[model samples]
Target: MAFIERYSRRTRWFHAGIYVAVLVLLATGWWLALGREGRPSPLARVTGLADTTVHLWTGWGLAGLAGVAVTVGVRAAGTFLVESVRFRRGDLRWFVRWPAAVWTGRFASHDGHFDPGQRVANLVLTGCLAVLIGSGVGLAFIDGGIGFVVLRQIHRWATFALTPVVVGHIVIASGILPGYRGVARSMHGGRLRVETAKRVWPGWLHRTQNR
Candidate 1:
């Protein structure tokens, strides 16, 4: 039997919105950046029209969604974002053991939440995005003939960083992760199977189910 539990509507929508916005921003930003200097790439022509205004609007939209998300599930999201860091002694042990546990079907009982790999990615991505947004705002002003060269350079690098991080995330999540099926179900169906609940959620499943 498949457990029909899924993400809350708020969480699902937040994730979906960010996913789309990020892709658009990347595509458009790439066009504007690469299409300069008489570059003749076809996609550049297609996306080159997306200027700082387009980038700013989409980025602000994403930031707005994040603001809403923080308010919607303050405690849960806060824990996942801020307090989820594993600084303790055995925390490191569990991080190393998690994969083996997952391989042998023992991940269900693991107490620590937010897998080590995910935390690392989240930290990197979050930091990169902050820099990207900060410098991007500067870029917009600079494009308008007001911002600094250093800010523009930082924005450029931050934008470039996004590509590799996103590509690696997709590849590793879809290719290497053992619980691909459950991950898909989580996104597709919005909920997870209670049977696989342990592996899917090492910390708390029943609490969410009841909520």
Candidate 2:
């Protein structure tokens, strides 16, 4: 019945802020990208701004939040990047067993803060965000040249690619999956039941205990 810290308080705040900013950016970006010409975007109507202006400011907000996230959690972010890339002994097995675990309400145990799937997801999401931010900055500030055109294309493609991944991540992490029920609290309150942690991440639990 004991609980263990899964995310620190600062980490939770960072996650919440980044999540909100990303959602706003996505909403504004997609409205501008997909809305029919001569039709007002719903988001723009609600915000009382031009769609292009909303998208521009939301992108800037996301960039500012990213800066704050990196500044406040640089050490943790570095540790996460290092851990995410290092392969562990059971990572392959965890991946192999993931499908069965998802359907059968079972889970494979693994070490570290992220499992293999999560590690891969983190890397992919990070790459997409980096592309979006970099290209967005170029589009906002650079003159209308070939470089700007290239950056715009990159931003458009990356935005489209990231949409599904983000949706899937939310669905899974929000505990809509049977076995994962209650797992979402780990991010909100920075804690998880010891039993659940042991069941889902025994290696990580053991490491934490040893520390």
**Could you tell me every candidate's TM-score relative to the true structure?**
0.72, 0.91
Indicate the TM-score of model 2: 0.91
Could you say which candidate leads in TM-score?
2
- Position 14, candidate 1: lDDT: 70
Model 1 agreement with the true structure over 84-201: per-residue lDDT tens digits: 5654555576566666764554542334445556667777777787787777666655644435778867767887877888776676544245653355565555666666665655
Candidate 1, residue 137: how far the Cα is off, in Å: 1.6
Task: Name the top lDDT candidate.
Answer: 2
Residue 104, candidate 2: Cα error in Å is 2.4
Residues 1-211, candidate 2, lDDT per residue (tens digit)? 6989988897888788778878887887876677552566787789888877877887888788778758886888899898788778878888888887865657767776776777887888888998999899889999898998899789989988888888978986887787666678779877788876776667778988899
* Candidate 2: residue 139 lDDT (0-100): 92
- Candidate lDDT values, in order: 0.64, 0.80
